[model samples]
Target: MSNVTLHISKNFKELLQFLKSISFSRAIRVGIAVTLPVLMGIQLGYFEIGLALSFGAFWSSPSDVSGSFRHKIKGILISATLVMIVSFIKGYLHFQLWLLLPVLGLLTFTIAYISIYGFRASLISFSGLMALVLSFANESEELEIYQYAVLIGVGGLWYLLLSKAWHRINPKAETEEFLSETFLLTSELIETRGKLVNPHEDHEKLQSKLLKLQSDLTTNHETLREILILSRRTSGWSNYQNKRLLIFVQLIEMLETAISNPVNYHRMDVLFNDHPQYIKRFQDLIFEMSYQLRMISEAGNDHRKLPKNDFMRQCFENVRRDVALLRETKYYEEYLMLQNLLEYQEKQFEKLKSIKRLLGDPNSTEINVIDRKKAKRFIAPQDYDPKLLLRNFSFRSTIFRHSVRLAVTVMIGYALGSIFAFQNPYSILLIVIVIMRPSYGLTRSRAKDRMIGTLIGGAIAFGVVFMIQDPYVYGIMGVISLVIALSLVQKNYKASATFITLSVVFIYAILSPDVLSLIKFRILDTLVGAGLSYAAMLWLWPAWEFVEMKESIEKSVKANKDFLHKIIEYYLLKGHIPTSYNIARKQAFLETSNLSSAFQRMTQEPKSKQREMNKVYELVVLNHNFLASLASLSTYIQHYDTTEASERFKTATEKIAFNLERVVQCLKDKTCNGAGASSEDTTLFDDQLPVFNYLEINTLKSNDTETLRELQEAHLVWEQLEWLFSISGRMLKLSASVKLD
Candidate 1:
């Protein structure tokens, strides 16, 4: 019994430590975020009004937690200010009700297109429209608009303060958490790269990892930017240092790409092997670069100018010189590829330098956008179509399903409001609208979490209202509501909802002066709202199609083919060609996300669709794995430097070229059949296939050992290519079996 007690105690301590590491402050901020909207509703003396505000607050919470205090505050101010301005125009200028929708839509499009305002623009447009519609219905003009501005300002201000306080306690701990994860991923890629054998597999895996790293980098970029803005306002270094930390991230990405691509590896390996002194110098340069970044991050914390250390300057010069040498010699054959990569890195360093400059000039007021354009454009072809709006309106599309769900929500809200004789039916509509965010396969899970949170919040509010019975409790409860509202500022939706419910109960209990009756009505109204939202979502579409997943798989396959084609063309052209490995990496990452989302969606669907989707998903996974293998092969080929070509090597190259052409033809025709070559046509050179026969090997001097070594390496690469084609062909065949079904 004593031993058991000790074990339990140890387990409990471990659990506590884990929880502490996860940033409780961020969670509390989320809770506060939820409470703010509720407070706004209370100030309006309408639960429905509060519910509407709370919806926007919930959606914005996730971004706030990861973003800068300035960004969050700016978003809130913009949204609230827009709402106020729109409300005023409707109330005072008496804008025509019919014109409001188009005006709001245009404003939303402009804001979304022009600025880095994020989701706040959408919130503003929706809220502004809501305000305009309400103004038209009530005809209560300027006074109502003023009241809204005051309430929204109060709520937003409360959130800002609360979020700031939370961050002060934690000190950019959340940002660190994200960065730490990114570093771990980088480390994993490095470890994998070190152990890579098959160039094809290595390439595919490296590209996959690189894509994931890029995504993580993009996410961190936004987070760090937010932190930087917050730090600027609060006289803090946490956010600034975090933004500077992105330099290391960019370096890691560069190194990972170089390590993954065979052509780059060969160039580096040859340079290092031929010039041992240069290799040591290169190592020293990298060390100095890393150290300089670390020093910059530390200096930024103290609000000091970043050091213009000699080591860093020398390291930069060395990198530039090496890149210049590669370009001038055209040594790698793909020197242009190397040049492009160097240019990208140079831009990244420049951005870092700019950030450092900004940190140095304390009085500089301009908010400069970081000139890092590393984010991959994965815009689907369908997204660019002018007919997208019409397609979205079609019954087959999810948007139409969402509209039906909205209609059901409105009907349910009206029915429940009439049945209970509630003063406002719009409150129910707002709740339903807010909760019914379009989700993929995890709709049930999300709904369950929301329901649980609502119940918990409702219970807490009931207890709080019951305890505080004085008339002055209304004002006191308002202050309590503020605290609760602030706590939800940077938390998840469920936790935020809990605080929102708690805030609403206190507001209603104090204002109505009837605790028990108000509590009963509040609970009923919330249940009705939540239930309606869930039912509408589940029954309307019933099945959410896994289109994103399908698109992802198709994109990945296309990218893989492109990468293969580039590598083959590079070798065949003989005069150094660039590989589209970077493009492939970006596509692979997208495919992973799409596949994951598809799997999740499949799980939610009926067994028949789920089975079919799962089969398709399996094919995607196989293709991803095959591409990774091909990447590894490419790396090996590039690394091998041989000057002479053997007859066997020439034969292997011919076979690979033939297979590739056939594969391309099949893809062009959208066919599942293997290439039309007969088994008897297994000759090294087919006279009828003029394209394959015309391919000639570049001749080198007999004494040019380096050229001979490259030729030998090219032969090995040819053999590996044949193997990859065989494996990939089989996988593609398997995938076709499922896709065709």
Candidate 2:
């Protein structure tokens, strides 16, 4: 009994966390926009009109995602216009199946096709499609079709105004929330890396966590970048913007520095082979730093003072003392490795100090004024070229395939409803539109979730209806469920489905006497919709993950190559890093994240479709590790004083670049002469593992500090380059092994 109770408690806590993770404020705003109309209509004895307004608000709310004010407004306005158009057209054509069937197909295809524009546009397009779906079920006989359409448009405008007012009330809310979440993620990343100090830790699990965190952090960084940079552009710069931007800059650099911090566990184990206590101390110190960042994140979120503690400095001093003690021994290699790690710790410490000074001290004048014109380069431009739409008309284009699949599925669903005469034919239409996706995995998952949630929700509603028959109670629960349903749709779709079911059933119970019948039909229609949707994905132009694996891998490798080129350039021209270098870095990170995400989705697919699964996983791991090794190389180059690039360094980097290029070509052409051939054919670097000769180590120990630093820098560069080259070669071999092309 105790164990069961504990399990329940744990799950309850997790449920609360999941709910808190979603933006309750946004959900409340949506609920308010939707609920106010119903309340007004009830007061005026016009429930049908209120319900239509609610539909418009619900459909338009999906476009209200976090973004710049201008883009947010633009998305909402476009969604409003599209919803009006879709609703108006659907209203006029509903009475004639012959006209409606063909028109619905065209409209569905066009709406799904517009998703090619981008994420925001895809969401706006979804709003329009949703409006079309809801329009089929409209029974507002009092208003003309045009009036109903106009009322929906007005509801969208009402929601838009409410959103604007909220923004005015708390202008920095989204920015602060995103920035704080980034900080928290970064802190988790730090703690995850810190775990590697322990020699017995599970490396695979840590690596997986690292990949997932990197993927999420990449999204947060890009979103926050858009919000801050684009807002500054529209509103002009201010002290408020300056402070936020400065914090963001520091946060970004901190993440890069953390990424670059080399976690060479093998070397650490060898060096501290006998001194495991040092590892424990180091891990504790890292956790302390992580905790400090967590505090800063919370403070930033709550508008409180950032921490200004000396705990990290004290921790660093202890580690330095350990290093000093080791310096008296004959362990020169161990001393050098520890010294290098200490230097990295110092850099991290300095970054923390900078952020603290800026945030905790208002009079600190360390604001780096960004060039407005140059800043635009950081925000990736969205091309709305009409040619893009036409170009994607081919069968090869996934969007085109998805568009056709959705149109057919919708028409089939409508026909099935007409033939069988389901109590609510529109219910089947709702399921088809809501569940279908561009990928097989997503559609299958949503179908499963919809089925399970509907069954569970039906059971719950059946019990609730028998136990309580009060309309007022049903009304309150319905509103609560609606808010929760909208809130969880993005975070946890299964829970969203359950709540949506509850919302629908409770609302209907208030209007109809036969609640059990409604529940039965709800479950039946959902099962039919779910089954039909998944069947469509399985049979109709199934976009198998393997088909796109080659392209994704190629892009990721190419991005890494470009990033490596930029890092080498920065080393050669060691001044301030150029914007192009940062851009290359961002692309590399983004592409790597994209590849990881694709691989994840592929895993969720049917086993028969998972061609070359093992090799593809290897390729993903190789690309991810290659980026990490490259980041390590960049970190050392950017932070330490180093000698000019040697011919040996350039030769090794060139070979690595060539290997990456070969991998790309192999992926592109589906052929490779041999994976081992070119890598083994290199002259300057050998196939044997990199090692420092005893004589070289002795020589370096005797040299002056500056000469030793330069030689050590060169050695680290050579080692990283060779490792990266090996990874690239492995990628080429794996790409060749896969028959993706």
Candidate 3:
């Protein structure tokens, strides 16, 4: 009997603990959600009145997960100040409603553009919306506007504090999560490369994956870079792990390039075959390097000592051989091209060593340059060229799409406001204008989320009003607001939605002194606003066709051709290619990004464009894969250890280069003429004596077995290159046919 009683008691205790845990989490989320809305209501009371105005402002400025706190805060502050000034001017000048309309329109457009470009455009947009709302609210009491600003400021401050606190607790976790995603993507690329049956087809897929990985890796690297800068501001926080993270990122990039162009690996094997130990050692070293990086990331600051076992020694030896082979092959050209990256890693590693040395000494006096200037210098903005931007915009029509969406949004907002005759009809217009947004693709998803969130929020608000009264309600609302603010930190949309829901409820129920009977009116108003916004989105110049997909695929093809031309030119120059190579790389990345954006947009459009968009998306994918293969081939060709090979390698390289030029010319002619051309006319892959003659002439005069073997491997690679180029030309022709049709 005693045992049974004890068991029951234990179970009850466990259940209580679980409920408490859940409640705590709920409180946090609720606190974050209600923080801003409640403050807005408290400062500017009137139940439905202030709540409606605050909702419009908040809706306009949805927080962006990608943006930094500083950027978001700066944008928000700028927007708030502008709104405040506008409000002040309205009171001072007593501007007429007719004159205010045009000014408000201009302000809206400027805010829209800034929001689009700025990290947290949503916030800026909201600020501008608030300003406009205040200008038009001639019926409302003047003091109400100032109260609204004070509340919003309070909410903003509360959210800012919560976000900062959360980040401090888990500064690197988000970065690590992003890195893990990249590593998984890298693994996928390797797996895909191993399964290639048709080199061309597989190569295309590889290129697509490589391009995607490169973009993702670059973005992730930026995040880590930011984190490292932030770490410097906090005493005892180290960026040593981040430096190692950057190294692995570079290594992964090289590996992807290597896999895409098997010829490079073949060349490496050829040059160091006699000393098989070198190749083995190099492989081991790469493995060790990857392992060490993972370890440092996992262990954080507690991690000490590199893996100095026998396995590490073997790997180091391999690294030495790989370096030697790279040097011997006069691959110095390739190394030089990638030299900046190498230097960056070396410097980062040196910094880590310095940090470690400092950590070792309790009284170390080394000055850690953790200032903004140093951070800015370290995290240089990727050089931007206007020409490239123009090229991308011209090819993909991204600007046109955005412009169309914006115009439609305003038109819908005006129509709804004029048509609807609710007590606060402008609220419906505000919702339409603010929610419809700059892109049709994202509008529906966000709108649906907003609807669901608002409904849930209304219910929560009703419950809070019924259960709590006065000061306790205010305290509970504050806690709920904190939770919503924290949800902004997560990547998931659902998290954001939940927080938004919680926020709306608290603002309506607790902050606003609207009577219990008026709760139903508030709910109805929210639904009406959501419904009108949704209707406007569906009917207003609805984008049924995805034109961007076709444009992106077409642009990618052009970018690929340009990249190939650059590679050919670089090889022809023999040593250290011009800066144009980097331009080509950047162009490729931009095209890929455009393709992704296009695809995302297409998914939101009507089903009519689905088939055409899918076909074009496939082509875009193929083009990316091909580009990756080409990049790999370039890396291999540039790094081939020519010292041990016969002169035949050089002669063959020149012949290959010449053939590539011919191919480019033929493609240009075909593109310009728009005429049908036969495969025979293109000399598609016929390995006649000229190709071999070039190879034979370039063979090195060496008697050593290893040297002879290296020469033989070079000849094999040359033959493979010839075959690959032929395949590529045919694929290009096929791609052109699809595009023309």
Best by TM-score: 2
Candidates ranked by TM-score:
2, 3, 1
- Inter-residue clash pairs, candidate 2: none
- Candidate 2: where is the Cα deviation over 4 Å? 1-22, 45-49, 95-99, 232-237, 261-275, 301-308, 362-366, 687-704
1-741 per-residue lDDT for model 2 (tens digits): 999999999899767644544376788899898889999998999987897888888788888898788898889889988998888888777457766777888899999898999999889989988898877777578998889888898888888999999888778778877877888998998898888667788877887788888888988988988888888433433656777777787777777767664535566666566777688768878888789888887676343566756777788888988876665665565656666667766777778777776677555455777765676687889989999999999889998999899998888888788889888888998999899999889999999999998888888988998999999999999989888887888778898899899999999999898999999999999999999899989999889989998899899999999999999999987999888988898889899989988898899999999988888888987788888888887778788867787666677778889888888888877556656666565654563334565224444454477866864675567657766777777777777678864
For model 1, residues 1-741, the per-residue Cα lDDT tens digits are: 999999999899756544554345554465556555666656877655564444334333433445555555666565555555555564454344345334533432332231112244445434544453343334432336566545444444555566667667876576555544444444444444433322324554554454455445444444553444344423455335534444444543433343343233434455445544444444454444444455554453345546675765676677667755653454543333333334433443454465456556655444433323322122222133445455555556554455455555555565567567785555665565456645534445445555676688778766766666765665555555545444443345677566656666666665576666655665666677777767766676654555444454565566565666555555454443232454454455445445544455566755544545545655554554545445544544443433344455456545544554444344344455653342333443333222322112233344775643444354335434544545455444544444422
Query: What's the CA error at residue 192 for candidate 3, in Å?
Result: 6.7
The number of the candidate with the highest lDDT is 2
Q: Against the hidden reference, what TM-scores do the models get? A: 0.56, 0.93, 0.62
- Candidate 2 vs 3: which has more lDDT: 2
List candidate 1 stretches off by more than 4 Å: 1-78, 85-177, 184-397, 463-493, 541-543, 563-584, 630-727, 739-741
TM-score of 3: 0.62
Which residue segments of model 3 deviate by more than 4 Å?
1-77, 85-107, 115-123, 130-215, 221-297, 304-437, 455-482, 511-539, 542-545, 558-566, 569-587, 637-675, 681-685, 688-731, 739-741
Clashes of 2: 0
